[model samples]
Target chain A: MTMRLVRTELVDSREILPGQWLQSFLAPELSSGSRAGQFVHARTGDLSGLVLRRPFSINTADPATGVITIHFRTIGRGTEWFTRLRPGDTVEMLGPLGRPFEVDPRSRHLLLIAGGLGMAGVRSLADEAINHGRQVTLLFGAASARDVYPSSLLPDEVEYVIATDDGSVGHKGFVTELVPDYEGWADQAFACGPAPMLAALARIAEGRRERLGVAKLGRKRGVGKPDVVGSTAARRKAFLQVSMEQNMGCAVGACLGCVIMGTNGVPQRVCREGPVFAAEEVAWESGW
Target chain B: MSPADLSVDLGRGLVLPNPILVASGTFGYGIEYGDVVEVDRLGGICCKGTTLQPRIGNITPRVTETPGGMLNSIGLQNPGVDAVVAKYAGTWAGWKTPVIVNVAGESVEDYVEVVQRLEGVSGVAGIELNISCPNVGRGGLQFAIDAGAAGEVTAAVRRATDLPLLVKLSPNVGDVRPIARAIADAGADALTAINTLSGIALAPSRRKPLLGNIYGGLSGPAIKPVALRIVYEVSQVVDIPVVAIGGVTELADVLDFLAVGAVAVQVGTAIFADPTLPVRLVDELTDECERRGIASYAELVGTALPPKPGAPSSKGVEYRP
Candidate 1:
């Protein structure tokens, strides 16, 4: 909710993979307040034919240096416009928008899952978890080793695991296959990926409790309490949290453009209500 | 030269401090931008499309970007009229600008009920009848295309509330003048020319439409010329103030709209790219008037209009049977 229209200067821009980029900005007003899963709506310098501003997740933020970075691939003309910028160029951005990944204070172990470009959405959380003295495990999936996110870019404290479709990396298969290995050990899971991938993870998270045979708690104070779905407290206690993306318009609740149907039969704004939500909160099969 | 005047009077005692109003659907309830935009500095604020009942709106992929514009089929998703007035009216009453509620409904009674509820509200300043919303299945577009339906709805709402009423025109119609005239004659204080034109974009898979509802209203710079043509034609035929809205991005676009006889221009799709553009345009417009040494911006209206009668909206208008 601490949002501002700040003018950020592109201090660094580099291509880490074949077509993927890692660009950093000097935004003092935003880097500190932005959380792990929040995003910034970056406007294109050349809006000659491109009208809408592109939304990018805050990949990493360094409050000490007043720097924040965004990761993206050349998907369309709007993104291509960002690749053409040089050092010291200015970009007008509105941030840090949407809800961030809510971590329970008592949790000591955290698991993060990402697919392809979805890495940008969860990369910052590793820093947050490590800074809080929590053990972190990151499982990533990519088409091939060429597209795999470089491990050096991550915090050294993170336990990096990778799966490539072509078997050019540690595991040969989808990243979801790696979740079961750590599901029991990790207290909670966070993810950002393709819809099918996230949906598959939601299915897995839904069955984890019964699979582990965790005892159903009896009423403590007359009734067993449960967190309300889609609420911040509910997300803070959920088994799995995800950062969702959609084709956005205003990057605010106004346009009602970037929405995903919730389990409660109401459409939630990815900009205002969340970029992050509990897996149970989303109606995965609803196909919104 | 003295300070240039930017105020706008839409008649029936609804006078705006300026002419740069934010279009509905883009600004939300004027709080989405947080502190980025100075809503009090705007001439007026047209909030999101409101209906009689709470609506959840359309499904996924509700918006997409095209060349020089964007397409959206939000399907009038709102928390209903009663919820809207209960939530934001108090905050609006404290602001310096006017907040015009944009009402959308499936029937004439629905429109009247929504307006009547807002009639005596303290924060509610006026009403903009959205008779041209094209997102919903029965989204009131029928009134926008036909003169009789347009007049009927306006007359009903006119009787229900004494608040300043402005009926928005849709550019999807073949000829907009008759409908514009009917609504004006039926007691609309102002006319907002050119709602979004209907359009669709293909999905990347090429197997389906990009938007969930399959069709959306096109807005942005792509629709500016079409809006100008409508403003020029309708202004000549209607006596009420013409408020043009389609794709206003910069001060030049604002001036261009004024030249075609729009007393005010609403900034719509451009807000997605730059939230501060509307407020900046308000300042730039005053600077523009000072540069021209004009005492008031009103002298700039209708400059592109013809000096004589018989000037058709387009070259083929007279040829149409």
Candidate 2:
């Protein structure tokens, strides 16, 4: 798809949590064509010190209203600058970029997992899955009840589950602890979070097939043919797919600034090859 | 007064329609930005660094933002010389803007071999030697640190191809004049001063270094002063033109570089914040020249340099340094 640099006007901005923000922009070009897991590289207003545009997952996109939203926490100058933007202020955005999450067509049950601000990464997928008449279970984890995503913002159709580190919330443990309850019920799983958490879930996903004793379908047709790591076909067939994060420069795969170690001993560009990848395709313990 | 001529020529058949170029490593191969930028309007595009073999580059956390700049340790990741010539040469040949390939190598022979492969490539207008890539393990900063090595590499590549050669200088040196002179005497058409200063940052946890390579080249406004000083020092010793690079985000930065004897300026880290900046600077520079009623931008060059020997040194070099 042709990526355009559009001048998007901020239509709404609000403080969703203590330090978290949710901003909406009137970007018809981005909202119309962007999928669930794609993101936009937004240019900040102050050019003096901040030299790189911030990459934000498209948290939500409404083509009917021509509005796209981004959810973020004010952790640094770039995020702080975004919070200061008022409605009517125009910001330049380069997007509908990076590969989007590929959901298997026949998968009727989809399990989504998100940690903290990573909710922004998988939030849109919930909406997209429901629109396709698939059942979605979103397992969200946060630091405490105060930092948990407000259920009022999600669609009424989703089965929202929460796990907080502190016992003040739903499940008093890591979100990966809540996966086993839904592994058997889910046909496919997608996640985005801290590396350790994703790695933990990946380990669990490895043993899931044997634990559930699920028959490997279509194995004979693909015998002797190794799946190409990071390929769309590989990600589609894997039980777990994850969205990865890195310190980025161009966000269009030019600078080679955001790369992660791949299983094949080659470095993968997060902005080009993925922000999405099959759990098996990444070399988790490579310490890259 | 027709939009003040901004074109510049860095000898040996290389002429930029304007003086603003997108720096190497930052602009990719000129196709990554898609329609976001008007590629044809740019003065030039220095595509990502190329080598004899495809390099995977460094590990994760290759970039980080500092107070007024950023540090990057990309290690010159590229698809190799042959792949580059095959993939982008045809596309670049169709554009009005010149595409200068930035070549990096692990050794002097590596640099010459890469240049030889690019000698007759259709889209290549010139060659920019990345002799000061601070991210690599070897051969990058080695060539730029010593005068003999810098000149030797420049001369080797000069013999390999007839392409206009621009050798990039490193800011890590204590004195840059000798290296600058050696490279110019070696037949380099121009010089690009300065490459990023070596620096490092701590991870958020403070457990270890932030960048995977442990060290990164710092660029942006933080290095502008250092760049201006090097350009001033190098331009005085070398007869060839100087193309200044380091944290150029606006017209004032461009003018500052030119005043210090830089014939052209390159926008590097700033492109990440605004991909359209290089093209915008070209327009703004023309306006600045017109506002000053200058016939061409060349009149603005070396305007702030110390007067010649017979004349008094207004504000002397020591004061600026």
Candidate 3:
């Protein structure tokens, strides 16, 4: 409901990797209320044929500075137009859209994962977790070293770990490979990446309790009252929550354009129910 | 500059404060925009396409951006009409603006039943019969492609509800004049021309179509000229007012639609880029009327249109729907 149309001025723009660009915008209205995993629907130059606004994860929001950053690769004309903006250039952005990653108050050690451009989806959570005095371990993956998100951009408190397909980084495999090592250590896991990567993590998060041999202490809280499927409480308690991606139209849920198959046999709007959802809420193999 | 009268009467008691409306499917229920849009400021709010039964919509990847437009195959996803009335009708009734519920169905009876349910609903200001939806497997393109079916459904809905009726035309047919005339004669108060044109985009793999529904209704600036042509042709043939829609991005586009014989205009795909556009367009149109030394926006309507009835033009096919 706090979603709004805010005029954002480009503060700075830079290419952090080979093709990935990170641009910062000063939007007090959006930055103050935004949560990690939530996104903004940005309008491009209207003169061109780009009819749909581009949706970007609120890569990072600095309420103190009234600045928000969006990280993306110049994949199409929309992004190409964004990169052309100068420092004083202003654009309209509809934001703080979609639901953000629901981190539990009880969680202390958080595990973050990102694949390629998916890093933009979860990068902000690290800053948030550290601000809450939570320990964070970030596992990142990309096709090559040149594509890795720069470590200089991350908070120093984060235990940054990287994986490259060509083995030019810390771990030479998919970031999911690094998850098991920290599985028992992390109280909760949050990820943003390709569908396959999230699916793999979902498979891993399923048996975590058994793998760690953690027993229910006593009347496992709220034993009879179930967490309503897509509620914030349900997502907050989920072991692994992922920020999803799909081709989006009206990021405001009206268009029903960006949807993913839900395990409950209904298609859920990625813009409404989520750009983020609990791992189990999604029908991982439904081929959505 | 003196204030130009921006009000529009769509006939049978559906009078709007202005000539700008947010197109169906784009504006949701008019509540989705929250504080971003001032709902009461616009001419009207056309709610999403509603069916007799709740629709789950199509598979994923329902939309994609095209050259100057976007392709959407949302398949008319909406809660059943009853749920729509139960949930959003009260809120709509409270707002000063009229909320027209857009009805779509597989059968004429289905359209009639939906209209009957909304006949006296407090928030339901008008019924826009959507026979032109191209995304659904059946029913949609069927009623729109032929003149008889379009008339049959419009007449049935007309008998069902006393509320104002507007039939949205499809651009998929070879010719649309006959169909427009048929709907007008069948008692629709006005015509909203044209609905999205059917089109397809290939996936990046180049092996398959990009949209899950395969073919999507093409909307946005790319289809403006086609919309203008239909509005031009249909306005010439029908006595009812033509509510123009399709890629209206600015005040200029609004004027263009008006000159082509559209009494009012709906901003559809452009809303995705600028949520405040329709309201802003209302202001711009008012200013335009003031600047043109006109007392009403109606004076600008049909300015670019050629002389009426059976007049031969260098352009256009002779065939009629």
Candidate 4:
């Protein structure tokens, strides 16, 4: 569906962690229309001289409850403004934007990975995968147990694993280390995290296809057939897809603010082409 | 009540159906508003600044908010004039409203070259010279501050094209009258004053500047007074019509610009806060004219221009002192 501005009321706000917040808005229009990997450009309170609306990934959307939640850290004035909004306060949002993660129908097992606040980027996919009768294994990394997302918020069907940087939780190392154990089990992997972690995951995903001589989905149809590299079909056939983040303007592709260097040498707009892209489409080390 | 009576001849027989034109940069290439704003309703659309070549623009943090306003150091990030004409001309040609191409360049040759390329473009209706983008250090200030340079470029572009040329004036210059007069003398169809005022904001940490470019151009409601001052001064000196820009956020601002001798106004920074403003202003202006029993909105223009010495407002007055 095309994107549009919507007004939603604050249903609830809670401190999911010490400095992290999970706020739910009562937006039936957004909850029903939005899909996994889409985001909302939320209007913040016009206090503290903030002008730009903050972009947040939809953490969870419950069409039955007509509610959508966003998870964020109180990094600056814009996010702080959202936390201060009282229940029943109406906030405007331009929404259901950017392309969603294209899951192949043939894939039955989906492996998800997230780092800290990146959970919001991949959270909805777990719900979507479970509803589609797919097995989901979520590998999450945080600074410590206190920073780990509560398992209670997730669907009971998901097998959740955690990695804390300080050894205060389940796995005591980087979350990428856990992917090898599930590489043979997972049909496809999707990740969202800091640039370094996503880069690491991309490297692993690239090697997995080669090391296993993995006959990628749809490959049986033809070996040398030319498929469009960046299309949803190509992304679904790949072993890994990643969600990216950048500072944005217009959020509607007018201003080219949120751009990431693509493998094609031209900068792709994160708001238009994607906040999500296949691992190979991005120039992982362009530093942009 | 006839719509034909509202048509205005903006020199060289380039008549506008009405007088409400969306300013350059703020409206992008006129397609940015999408379905939210009806582009055909506006009198015209002045597109974003187009250079001879594509510009990557300034570093990150290009825009920020200031007190009752905002600052932008966009650095004229465009995909060159040719790319723009190639990409948007077909779409623009399909529209009823005229699309005025806002041109900016680094030198006299650059200005002439860009305008020459725009000549005879089917979609393009006119040229709006953005000679006052303050974010760039070099070419931006050179043409705006010096009258001779401004006129030199204007005359060069005039020689290059028969298109309606509207030269935008910078508020940074001291006394815009001579500059306005020089531009008018060079045969510009109209004048647009003023572009943004140069300003800087320190970072919150106070260790560095807030904007990535270290400095930015001040716009929005805060610069309305400065814009009014420059427009008021330039209107008295120039014979050609003056279109005003800078800090026009509401209907009052449009009226204020008209009262201060601006034939039309361009809404800029305010489009960020309210994208529907320009369209709303067009409706409000017509309603305002109807309420005042004026046949056209042009009748409201220059109503506060300190009555030229022997005009009606000064005819009966005497030196009582």
Candidate 5:
């Protein structure tokens, strides 16, 4: 994909949660081509101290309005700098980077799960799925009700469900606990969250085919070969895909800073090969 | 007034078009930012560290940002020397900027082998020996810490290839003067001082180390002073031209390195924040030279070093504790 350096102006910024923010930028270049699960590396104004651009998942991209939103928590100075930005302020962004989620053409039902800020990763997919007339179900987990991503921010067609660890919201438990109810109905699943939660989802996804007694169904006559691991084709065929994270630098894959251990024992760049990957492609047991 | 000349000569017929260069690891093979940066405008591009074998690099969480800088444990992840030549050498051959292959290995033979493979290859202008990678388990920091090992490795590589060789110095050492002297004596064309300083960061949870590798090399504004100190000390001792690299963010930092005896500077960590910084610095340096009314940037080099001592301090022993 062709990545561009766009000068985006801050269109709006609001604290969506206690510490998290959902800010929108008017970047026509990004909104036109960026897909769900892709990300942007936004530069900070204060360059003296923070020498690295922060990587954020494209929470939503509205081509009609030329606006793309990024959701992030103020965990450090970079995010804090973003918080002080005014509406007219302009920032440089390099994106529509990394591989995006690959949906199967025949799939009619899409299940998306996110943990805390991970909502930012999968939020856009819901809109894209709904726009395509595919049924979308979103399962979100947070520390409590106060941290839950507001339903008003999501598309109206999405079937939203919530799980809170402290029992302050719907379905008092980890979001992974709710996957069993939807796994049989969903044709494909996508997730982004804490590694443990994603790992747990991966474990459940592995048993889904057997538990439901469903055979691998979509290969055409005489064209039934396994797609290579880590390829986009492989991800489209898998039952579960996940967006991954790592401390990053030079998000364009130049710096080997943002990498995760792949099942092939090679370190995959979270900023390049992913931000999204099929469940089986990743070596979840590798504690990296 | 005529424009100031920023050309730098590192001997053996190798000359940089200007004094600004993008450091090895930060720029990848130099094509990663093709759309964003004008790569041909820079003085030189030191491609990512090439090794004898394809390296997968470190585990996850390889990089993290600190207060004023960032720490990285990339562990010299590369596609091996053969693959590098086969993949990017053709592309680099078409660029105006000279591409220096930064070579690293677990042993002297490994370094020599990588350099040998790069020797006489089209598009490869020089070799920047990366003897200071601290993330690896062995042979990386070993050659850089001791003067003898440093000299031996340099000498071995020197005998292996005739390309202009630049050995990178590690700032993690106690004293850099002897090591710099040893590398120079081993017939290195020039010296690049200094590599990243070894450091560590803890995860937010504090349950384990932040980086997959327990230790990472810290780079950026935070290590500028330390890098300057090493460049100052090493430049005074070595006869070869010193190309400084540390926290070079702007033209001022480039001038600071030159004032401290560095003939040229390589922008490393700053490229992460702004990919076009090195090219901008080149323009800024020319403007700075014009403002100072200097015809060449060489006039600005080594303006801050202490006057050479006349006959080795006679009272040196009297001050010993």
Candidate 6:
């Protein structure tokens, strides 16, 4: 669905994890229309010195309550400002901005990988996949055990896996190490994380097509033209899709601040062409 | 209300249906607003800066919030002149409002080349030279800084295209009179002042600069005083119509610009906070004129300027310095 600006009221704000916050807003326009992978550009009170509105991924949207939750860390003044909002205060929001993840209907098994605070970008997709009756396995990576996303917040059906760099929690080393074991079983993979991790994931996904020997579906052994670069159908058929991040402005494709280099030799707008892109479409090693 | 009364003749026979034009960089080729804002209602649009070749722009964190304003160092991130005209000219050709292409470059040749390409384009109505880009680190000479370069580039581009030309003035310069005089002497039809004031913001941790580019252009209500001072200074120096752009948040700010000899005003950074402000200002301006019993907005122009010494004018002293 196309993006629209909506006004929402702060319903609840809580500290779900250390230095991380989860605030719920009662907004119907966003709750009913927002899909997995969509985000909201929220305007903070201008009473303080803050002038620009902040963008956040919709962590969870409850259609019944008309409430949507956003998860974020207090890394700067903008995020810190959000934590002080009262329950009844109103905020102007522009959303569900940007293109969303396109999940193939035929895919039964979905793998979601998130690193550190990147979980917010992929968290909603888990809710969506489970509601669509797809089997989901989530691999979350953090610096330590305390930084991990709480399992109680996730749907009971999702198979959750945790990895910590310090060996203070579930599995030691990076979360990408767990993907190979499930690579053969899963039909599609989606990830949101640090640039280094996303880059690593993109490389692994590029080789999976050859290693799995998975037959290219519905092509009839290559007949017609290739799927248009950066199209939704192209992203759905790809084995890996990533949600990219950048400092944003306008959040509606007006400001070209948030952009990623594309394989088509053009800078694709992350706010328009994607915050979600097929792995191959990105120039991962160009050091943008 | 008569729509005919709203029409304005901006010298050289160029007329506009209204006076509410979107400033460059903020509007993004005039299509970014989509359905949120009615482009047809706007009088004109100054698109983002276009150069001879594509610019990747500065690094990440291009924009940040400051006190009563915002700082940006976008560094003219455009898809080059040819790509820009090819991508949006057709869409603009279909719109009722005119798209004034704002061109910026490193040299005179760059400006001429870009303007030459836009000369016969269907959607392009005019040209606005961005002579005040202050974020670039090296070899980026601010055109509005010196009278000689400003006059040279303005004359060169004036010769390159028949499109109406408007040269933007930088506020960072010590004295704007010489530069404004040179640009007008070089054949510019109008002038826009002032671009953002040079400024920087500290990171929240207070350890470093907030913007990735370290320095950024300060824009918003915070810079209104500085912009007003420059507009007042440049408008008196040049006979060409002045198009004032600064922290125009309300009708009072608009009136203040007009009082200082600005024939028209372009609303910039303020749009991010209030997108409806420009349209509102249009209505407010009409009401203000009506309330004052003035037949046209022209009566409000230059009311604050001192009387010219040689020319017997009743207005306020031309600053001799």
In model 1, chain B matches the true chain B with a TM-score of 0.94
Two-chain complex of model 6, DockQ on C-alpha atoms against the true structure: 0.48
Question: Whole-model lDDT, candidate 2?
Answer: 0.91
Residue lDDT tens for model 3, A55-144? 999999999999999999988788889988999999889988999998988889999999999999999999999999999999999998
Give the per-residue lDDT digits (tens) of candidate 5, residues A157-242: 89999999999989999999999999999999999999999999999999988999876545555457666666888888888999
Worst 10 residues of 4 chain B by lDDT: B133-142
Q: Write the per-residue lDDT of candidate 3 for residues B1-101, one digit (tens) a residue.
A: 66999889999999999999999999999888888889999999898999999988888689999999999998888879999999999999999999999
Candidate 4 vs candidate 5, DockQ winner: 5
The A-chain TM-scores of all the candidates are 0.96, 0.97, 0.96, 0.97, 0.97, 0.97
lDDT tens digits by residue: candidate 1, A66-100: 99999999988888889999999999999999999
lDDT of 4 by residue, B1-321 (tens): 532234556687577767778777677898866876788888788898999988766664666767766677767778898999999999999998888899998877788899999999999889999876432335356687878878888998999999999999988877788888889999999998888888998887999997777778887788889999999999999899888887776788899998989887877766655567777888888788777788788788898988776645653467545
CA displacement after TM-score superposition, residue B280 of candidate 6 (Å):
2.9
DockQ of each: 0.82, 0.74, 0.79, 0.34, 0.73, 0.48
Candidate 5 chain B: worst-modelled 10 consecutive residues by lDDT = B132-141
The per-model lDDT (C-alpha) reads 0.91, 0.91, 0.89, 0.83, 0.91, 0.84
Q: What TM-score, computed on C-alpha atoms, does each candidate reach?
A: 0.95, 0.94, 0.94, 0.88, 0.94, 0.91
Give candidate 5 misplaced runs (Cα > 4 Å). A215-218, A221-226, B133-141, B307-321
Report the number of backbone clashes for model 1: 0
Task: Kindly indicate the candidate among 1 and 6 with the higher TM-score.
Answer: 1
| Each prediction's RMSD to truth | 4.6, 4.4, 4.7, 3.7, 4.1, 4.0
